[model samples]
Target: MGISPELRSLNLSNNHLEGPLTVSSIPLQLQSLDLSVNELNGPLLLDIPIPEQNFSLEKLLLADNKIEGPITASLGTMTSLYILDLSNNQLRGNIPDSLGNLTLLTVLRLESNHLNGEIPACLTNLSELVMLNLASNELEGQIPKELGNLAGLASLHLEKNNLQGLLPLSLAQLSNLQVIDVGENNLTGNIPSWIGTCSSLLVLMMRSNNFKGKLPPQIGELTELLILDLSSNLLYGEIPNTYLNLAAMVVVNEDMSVVGEDRHAPSARRVRPCGAPSGARSRHPPNIRGITPDSDHNYYGTCVDYVYGNEDRRYYIEGLDLITKGSERHYAYVLSGMACIDLSNNRLWGHLPAKIGNLKGLMFLNLSRNSFNGDIPGSMGNLSQLESLDLSLNKFSGKIPFQLGSLDYLGYLNMSYNNLSGVIPQQGSHMITFDKSAFWGNPNLRGCPVESWKCSPPHSPLSPPTIDVKEEAKEGFSWYELSMGWSVAAGFFAVVLVLTFKVNWRKTTFDQMDRAITFLLGERTN
Candidate 1:
């Protein structure tokens, strides 16, 4: 195939292109190449013919392909590279330690591959690194303590690996970190208290691990935290009411500007398309380099160039997996505006804080499979934005609060397998939509809308007083009956008095009575 030596960018993604990619075919001047979502197979050959010093490639995306074999150390020679994505491929073997040489690198993604071995401590050498994703690999061993050196790191994803040992203490140095997912690993030990020091944290997931101990109250200091998932662990102790300090969860209008402000913006910054003439002015302001500053570009930093022509490829970077509505759901760009707390499948016990209602912006809450007891906070009705709530398999007992009937946005609710009793709330449009399953296992609970369980009707001021059958039978007459008899006798006396005083009326009545009596006598004689 013939190609222009001046070519600076080539995007042929989502095609049926197959066979091994010939690194030598890439142009020396190429600054961006995106061949993602294709059938490209065979070992990735980074032995490009161009001299490393002259190579201008700044972005390389080969995700979602059939590429295999260990990453070539030669890749580190691409000094100008800032974005490197090889995710969702069949690549195997250890991540090349030489990759640390890419001092200008901002994003490095090698997830969803068979890469093994301990993470190279030298990776911390990339002082400008913004995002590092190495999840879903065969990696083992403790995370490197040197990682704290990457002070600019904003997102770190190491979930679904064979990692072990306690979280590194150095991580507290990451003041700008927004997301940290170390879930589904063999990590143990209590969650570090210094976590609160990272005040900018937005998502913190450490579920499905062996972590045990009381939750640190310091976590409540994360006023900006949006997602907090510590589920499926051995953690015990009641949740701290200090969680009410999560300011981001309390206000419906979240400050999304914090998502990628350090490196990019959630909103796409307009810029010239790759290969656009350098002298040409774009309709929007240019970003660092010619690249459009997008959350996907600078946060996940996937090597896709989206600022081309009429196409605005704003991609949501998958950041979390949360169990919602009885299934695991992937959260991506919307994570910025999402507020959720999942502490289910633990040994936590106690009444939820009534102040929890202060988190009016919370959207998902799961406290199932715990030892929590006592009445569900009626203050929960204040969560006007709540969409899903799970409080199943607990010791909570009491009447479901009628205030819950006021939640207009509640869509999924599960309060089953509890010690609850009394009528299920049946007022809100959303609340009435729930079936009996929502209140199952609570044998004491009764009401319509949950099932045909017999429940006493609510009292009304206009309703007549109830009568006791046994008492009425013993007395032979009720107050209601006595009142009726008195009314009849009073009417008779009043009529008698009126007839006696009014002689004309008295004569009229006597004449009518005499005529009726005479008619009756005649009929009988005949």
Candidate 2:
């Protein structure tokens, strides 16, 4: 297709367009190009020979394509570019250091590619950056300490890489940061206490790392934090009771308008196509800009034609991997009102804080495979929104609280391999749905679902009558014996009275008895 120099925006996204993109195909005045979600292959070669000052391109989105080869260094010449997303492509080789020159860049996404080598420290020179996602790449070496210099940065994703070393203390300077995911790396050292200082943090993930030491109580200071995943670490010690201070987890927020709003003021302007770039001489502006012309020789701007203003930019949490319902679920973006805490697979020990019930909004909680002891807190029932709970493989003792049966939203529960005893909570609609496996390995625990572990009836005011049939029979026998004795005595007294009153009858009876005796004696002699 022939290009128009007047074309300012070209969005051919989600098409079957294949083959490499050429520099000449892009219009000289094009300010935005979106060819994402296509089958485009071959190296992304944009070697336009336009003067740097005259180049007005601002947004280039080619994500989710099969584009390969090293990122062209000439892209660095586009000083006006602010949003560059080349993610989810087959792009290989090192990230061009020349990208650091795009000082006006706000959002840079180079993740899900084969880019290797140490992260270019010069990339931190983009002071206006608001979101930096370099995750899921083959990058090595320590995270740049200079990243703290990007004061406006809100999200930092360096997960799923071979990066190593301690998280730089300088990162504590990121006051506007809302999400920081450095999971699945070889990073080591104690999780810094200063992390609590990032008060704006909403999601903090450092899972699958080698970090060790007692979890800092200061982390509880993040009152608005919704998701906290520090699982699969070497951390030990009790969960701090101060976590009750996480107020966001304690109450559900129905209004998600502010959920992922940019902490930094948006710098991108809302642009519209204006009359064929001023110099067109036609009586009617040609429909070359892919817009329909009106009777007055003018074209109206559609919602899709403009940048930044087309959608709600506030709902942007790139991706998250969380374990819920006994499996890993990848969330494209965190549910606005969801809250979770995963501290499993650690050495954390001691009684779980009874105050955990304060987090009524918590949806997923995994404290399994720890050394937590003491009775499972009945207060957990106060978590009206709890959907998944895993407390298995612990040292907890005592009866599973009947209060848990009140959780109407509970769908997945695993309390197995603990020292817990007594009947499983079976009153709720959800609690009974769980199978025997949810309570397996607890030798002392007894309930209906556990095959051979039948629970004995508890001694409560509402318990059924326990009177034995044998005891009732024994009591009846005693009454019968008394009645029989009384009847025999009465009959004997009556017979005595009769014999005394009827003397004639008594004499006759005696004579007959004497005659019978004499007859018997005579027969024996014969």
Candidate models: Cα lDDT each = 0.78, 0.77
> Which residue segments of model 1 deviate by more than 4 Å?
48-53, 254-318, 452-526
lDDT of 1 by residue, 377-399 (tens): 89988988788999999999998
Model 2, span 226-328: residue lDDT tens: 7899999999999987776586787654332322122233323321112222222111111122222331123211001124444322213256788898999
C-alpha root-mean-square deviation, each candidate:
14.2, 18.1
Estimate TM-scores for all models.
0.76, 0.76
Model 1 scores worst on lDDT over the 10 consecutive residues at 281-290
Clashes of each: 0, 0
